[model samples]
Target: MDNIAGTKSSLVWAVNIAVVVLVLLWTIPTFGLLVSSFRDRDQIATTGWWSSLFPHEASLRFRIGDAETQRQEGEVFVIDGSVFEAGGTVSAFGTSNRDPAAHEPGEVVDFGDGISGTVNEDGSYRVTSPVAFEGRSPRLFVTSVTPPRFTLENYDRVLFAQGLGRAFLNTMTVTIPATVIPILVAAFAAYALAWMEFPGRSLLIASVVGLLVVPLQLALIPLLQLHNAIGIGKDYLGIWLAHSAFGLPLAIYLLRNYMVGLPREIIESARVDGATDFQIFLKIILPLSFPALASFAIFQFLWTWNDLLIATVFLGNTQDQLVMTGVLRELLGSRGGDWEILAASAFVSISVPLVVFFAMQKYLVRGLLAGSVK
Candidate 1:
């Protein structure tokens, strides 16, 4: 008994260590992405996400004032404000994103005809006028020290500005129905396959398994045309049917395997008790097959949540019908530089799957153990 206990302890320790390592490997980068998603766009580009927890200093430059805005406040015709601050290094300055770092910051790099700003150690710079130099505009240069940035701007941008909350609601609508419909249909089919006696059953099951191998990509255009012919194109019902059809094959296969593993005696006794096929299925088969159902629900929820290709193809990517994938794709086009927005968007998209997994994982184990002993 002592030896057995020692062996079990060793196995548990090994399993725990493995689980810990795997979790960390998966979570560290995800956490980094989460932090990056909350940072300023420029800050995101400059430093690693882990460095966000500590203070950071970066250099930048700005024009003191427009040429027209400049007034004779003093005899020197002074440019009073400082462009750059003390903490960050101002290595360069430029007028545009393309020329953003053209002149090295803090070097007091000379512009022709005495038009230049000297960045001070305190982060302020003063540009002096020639006293006779006249132009329609003042040439802009900038320097600055920015503190470490953390912002909720990404959440605001994605959730409100980009209408991602609406997309999220749309996704939930599509995902819930898409997941439920197939499982309902597949459960019936799987019960019939496992428990009903009918001719050509093996052949029918074989046909479904075969359909699993057929690439969904090949069917996209044909399906769209089919939906359009049937007057269901570019609508919620069409996309739901599309998702259900795509999810059905695997769902039936899994449930059928699990149901067939159930003891024949229980089903036989239920029938002997004068329970009809429908009653037996509802009372005996369903209650026992829950683990399998829960397991499949988890898979369906995750797949539907993350589906970019099918949602885009079936739903017609309109603003009203647009799901999370469509929204994320739009964000990539419009605000690709915003890491915080991307991170928050990704987190929102995945939140449901994580919750479902945690809630239902126990059923997966219970379902797999089903019929094992019998």
Candidate 2:
């Protein structure tokens, strides 16, 4: 008894420690992505994502006077309002956004020309020179402490910038139908395979399994030809058909296997009570196969949602028909350095998957194989 208790206690302690370590490993990066997604583009590249969660010091540089306002003030050339009453200790300033810490506040930093500036920590800075910069932009850097700052800039930029809004809508149009049609068609086929035996049943099952090995690329050109002949043209309808075709083989295989495992007696009992195949299927088979249906839904939905290659071909690359994946790909080429935008967009794309998993998780089973063992 003592030995058993000791072993169990030791195992529990180890498990707890392992869990704690794993959680930390997953947590820090995820937190970084989450924080990074909300920061401004410049802030994201300069500071670590973790910095967004807490306040950090930032500097702001503002000028007080223009060239025309330059006047002789006692012993020096002074511009009207050039002296900022609101001043504090300067820490650091940089000429470029790439490095905001090249110079410390209160230090006069040279810009290779006559331009020089002194920054203070109180969000106030002064730039002085022999000549005044009037009627033009004077570039200066300020370094101040900024607290944790988050901006919805990335999400806004992703949704409104470029043609992402239209692409997002297009993705929804394709994904919803692509996901629904296959499940509906595959559900019926799976039922027929599992419960309703017909001529060449084995051959049909083998054919579906065989198709699982076929690469989608091999059929792309042929499928396009078929679509054009059928007058579907290159549009959402065509993409839907393409996705449905690619998704069906796996869908039928999975759903049929699950449906075949349902209790035979329950199906038989319904049949004996004068219930037709359709009625029994509608009332008894479907209700019992909820787990299987949900599982397939999750699979098909996610697959169609993330699809890009087929979308590019069937739906056309035009803004009106492009999907989220296509839009995101374009953004990668055009705005590769915008990590915050990328992270935010990535999280946005995964939101539906997360919802799908959580909603249908109960259907994901460990024991559909229970009867198999017997």
Best candidate (score: lDDT): 1
- Shift in Å, residue 267, candidate 1: 1.2
Tens-digit per-residue lDDT, 1-374, candidate 1:
55554567777799899999999999998788878878877678778887778765444435455666555646545565655433454445654445666665455645556665565545555666667346643454444445566788777877887788999999998999998989879988999999998999999899888886789899899999998998998888988898899889878888898899899999999899899998998898889988788878777788898898888988867778999988888878987877777888987877777787677778655644541432
TM-scores, each model vs. reference: 0.71, 0.75
- lDDT computed for candidate 2: 0.74
Q: Find the candidate with the highest TM-score and give its number.
A: 2
TM-score of 2: 0.75
State in Å the error of residue 246, model 2. Answer: 1.9
Cα lDDT tens digits, model 2, 1-374, are 65554567777799899999999998887677877888877778888776667667656555455667666545444433322343333466776656767877667676545766665555455555665455754656556556666788778877787566677688789988888888878888889998886899999999998998898889889889999999998988888888888988878888788789899999898888999988987898778877777766677787888877898788788778878888778778987987977887876776777787777666544223321333
Worst 10 residues of 1 by lDDT: 365-374
Q: Residue 54 deviation, candidate 2, in Å? A: 3.0
lDDT of each: 0.76, 0.74
Candidate 1: list runs displaced more than 4 Å.
1-25, 58-149, 363-374
